[model samples]
Target: MKKTVVVGMSGGVDSAVAAATLVEQGYHVQGVTLQTWEPEDNATTSKKWQERGCCKIGLARFVAQRLSIPHQVLDIRERFRSAVVEDFIGGYSAGLTPNPCVRCNERVKFGCLMEAARDLGADYVATGHYARLLSGGTRGPHLHKGGDPRKDQSYFLYRLSRAWLPRILFPVGGLRKEDVWPKAEAIGLPADEVKESQEICFVTKG
Candidate 1:
């Protein structure tokens, strides 16, 4: 049977291309987006919503349809609040600058999401992160910098559990960020028109 992979699509060019690349490689790809934040007030106005990464569920669905894959949005707001939100707030309270992306990857993306993928009988969970997973090295598994140094995301993913490395995939990790949009467009995924996700998905700009 062909392996099944659940890809975390943020509706950005990288993730759009990641899903398409996996489909081309013969894996049964499923797309999932996490609804991690909800604005408490006017902070979540339409303009601000468009700026958050995880709020692009519409575009993610568009990419899934283009790839002919099933897509779903997982409401992980409560968990994200305790796992990442509180942690981020705590860090600031302690006068420390924390990397919430790293924490989210370790606790949410690869943590909660991987568990969900397993529940769906998927063999792996994939994302658009620009980092590569290498196996059978001198050690059991290693996460390496992506091929494109300018866009490598290894630093943000350094906190991922070593045990989960075997079941994780980053299809676009080998490509330059510059090439991701064109590839998404080539695959007819509409997310090529979506802006790149560069901000913290949960933080609202004041």
Candidate 2:
């Protein structure tokens, strides 16, 4: 029987390629995009939000369709606001610098996606994060730096529960950033149409 994996697709090239690669590997892949924030009703604000780093539901669905896999959006806006956004504000107000990405990864992204995976009877939860997992060791699965040093995302994943390590997958972790683009292009994804955003999804530029 093929193992089922619920992939967190962020509508970006890396995630699109991740889902495609897993499907090619014969896993039953389901693409899921987390709606972590509420966009403003205005068209200009909505357009700006879409240009950010997260919640590209339309593009995510398109990628899923191209891969011939199932896709769905999981709304976790309230949870994100409380766990990540509010926490970020609190931290800043307290004179501490907080990395919202790290908090989101730990409290919202992996946490919520893992729950969804279980509800779907999935064997594992996967993401496009550029980090590697090393297993078969005396200490069990350990998270390691991805193959691409420049794009390594292990730092953002440090807060993940150790127990969930074995059930998590990083499909694009071994590929370099440049290599990921070619894979995205090969899969017929609109590589040029999607630009990678470096800013926080909920925080707009002034």
Candidate 3:
């Protein structure tokens, strides 16, 4: 039986290519975009959302169409806001610098979305995160640097469950940025040249 891999698609080039590569490798792939923020639809936030990329919500549909895979949008805004954003604000208020992305990886990325992936009958959840989860059910899930040291995101992913190690795939973990570009271009994604973002998606620039 083919394993069903639910990919956490962010509508970005790396994730888009990751899902494509999974398809080429013969996994039963589905794209699930976690809607982490309840957008205000105001001009300012709307402009920022446009600038940062839509997480490929609608574009995930397009990518699914292009790859002939299943796609779903899972709304995790309230959950993320409660867990990550609240912690961030509280931390900042207390004079501590909080890492929302790390909290988000623990709460939103792993906490909320992983449950959804299981509910959808997926055997595993995958993403384009640059961190690698090695050690396969040992050391409570060892999160480490990606093969591409330049883009490794392990620092933000140390809180994941060790049990989920075998089930998560970082398709772009080993590949450098230069290697990822052609895959995006070949897959016809729209954001080959878009700048990668920093800070939490909801945390606005000053």
Candidate 4:
């Protein structure tokens, strides 16, 4: 039987290609988008929210449909607000800078997504994060920098629980950023329509 994986789709080219790569590798892939926040009433805020790569639920669904795989949304807004947003606010208020992305990766992405994967009877949880995992030593799986130095995301994931390492997968870790676009386009992912965003999903810029 094929191993089952629940991929965290951010509705961006990287994640879309990640799921597609795993599918081609013969894994039973299920796409999951984490709803971390709700759009505000302000038109500007709503529009900005939709433009973010991470908040594109509609695009994620479209990618999943194109892949002919199951897709679902997991709402974790309350948790995100408490763990990441509140922490960020409190940190700044206290004259300290806190990185919400790191906290989210530790508390929500790996923590919550791992649980969701288990609930779905998935053998592993995957993401488009540009990081690599090396296994086979007595120490178990080790997280390393992705092959693409420009896109390496290992720093953001440094705080992930070591216990989750072996069960995690980064399908696009070895692919170059430039190479991913072609793969996305090849798989009918509407590559031209998808724009990359560096902004935080829950935070809107002025």
Candidate 5:
């Protein structure tokens, strides 16, 4: 039986390429997008909210259809609010600068999504994060910096439990950000058509 993988696609080039690569490598791949927030939540904030990336919601479905893979949008808004957003807000009240990405990766991505993958009988849960995983050794699994130092996301991923490392896949970690474009295009993916995702996906302003 082919091993199955549930890819957390954000509708970006890197994730698009990651899913495509895993499919090319003969793994049974399914794309999942976690919808963590709503525009109405930030409606009264500012004009920056207008810049929120709609691609995150729509494009993932587009990419999945293009790649001929099953796709689903998981509504994680309540979970994200308690696990990441509220934690981030509480951190500010306590005068601590919380890294929500780290929290999301540890709590939401690997934690929640991993369980989802297991329910689907998937052997692994993959993401487009720019960090590599070294597995199949006596030392267990090790997470390493990506090939592109400039875009290395190891820091955000350090909070992930060591146990989950074995089941995690970072398919694009070995390729530089620039290299992902061509690979994405090679798969007939609309890599350049979508605008780049914002730095902070949850917050509209810095």
Candidate 6:
């Protein structure tokens, strides 16, 4: 059987191309979006939400629908807050520093989303994350850069394990952004050509 891949599509061009590349590679692909953190009255976060590209579910769902793949929206609000969110605030509160998205990638995205994909019959979970998984003959798993350094996401994924490395796929890892879009367009990939999202979703709530 062709391996089944569950792709975490965040409604962005990068992820849109990722899914298409996987399908082109003959893997049975499924798409998913995570609904993390609802917008509370936290003005600070809300302001940031209004800023730039944040993870947006509507955008993600739209892309999934366009791709003609089954899309599931999983609520990981509590998990994000505890694992990625609180740790973010806690880091600043303690006068130390933290990387929330990295936390999300490790604790929630790879951690929780992987299990969700398994429940959906996926043998492998994929993301549009621009990090490549490298397994040398003897070296443990390492994340390498995407062809597009501007979009490279390996820094946030350094914590992913050697165990999980083999099960993860990065369709956009080898391709540059310029290459991704033209191909996606040729394949009739569905996703906004121009998206305004750049912040985490929950930060936008009222």
RMSD of each: 3.0, 2.3, 3.0, 2.8, 4.0, 4.8
Candidate 4 is scored at a TM of 0.92
What lDDT would each prediction earn against the true structure? Answer: 0.82, 0.88, 0.76, 0.86, 0.81, 0.72
lDDT of 4: 0.86
Error of 6 at 66 (Å): 2.2
**Tens digits of per-residue lDDT for model 1, 87-178:** 99999899999888889888887786687798899999999999998786766778999999999999999988888888899999998877
Off by over 4 Å in 3: 39-49, 136-141
Write candidate 2's Cα lDDT for 1-206 as tens digits: 99999999988888899899999999999899998866433445335325675777777877898899999998899999999999999999999999999999989999989998989999999999999999857889999999999999999999999989999999999999999999998988777767787888888789
Candidate 4 lDDT by residue in tens digits, 54-140: 557777777899999999998888988899989999998999988888899998778887988989999999999999998859989
lDDT at position 113, candidate 4: 79
The better candidate by TM-score, 1 or 3, is 1
Model 6 residue pairs with clashes:
52-198, 53-197, 53-198, 53-199, 54-197, 54-198, 54-199
lDDT-based ranking, best first? 2, 4, 1, 5, 3, 6
Give the C-alpha lDDT of model 1: 0.82
RMSD of 5: 4.0
**Model 2, position 136: C-alpha lDDT score:** 55
Residue 94 displacement (Å), model 5: 2.1
Off by over 4 Å in 2: 39-50
- What TM-score fits each model? 0.90, 0.93, 0.88, 0.92, 0.88, 0.82
Instruction: Show model 6 residue runs off by greater than 4 Å.
Output: 39-54, 187-193, 196-206
The TM-score leader among the candidates is: 2
Total backbone collisions for each predicted model: 0, 0, 3, 0, 0, 7
Compared to the true structure, candidate 1 yields what TM-score? 0.90
Best by lDDT: 2
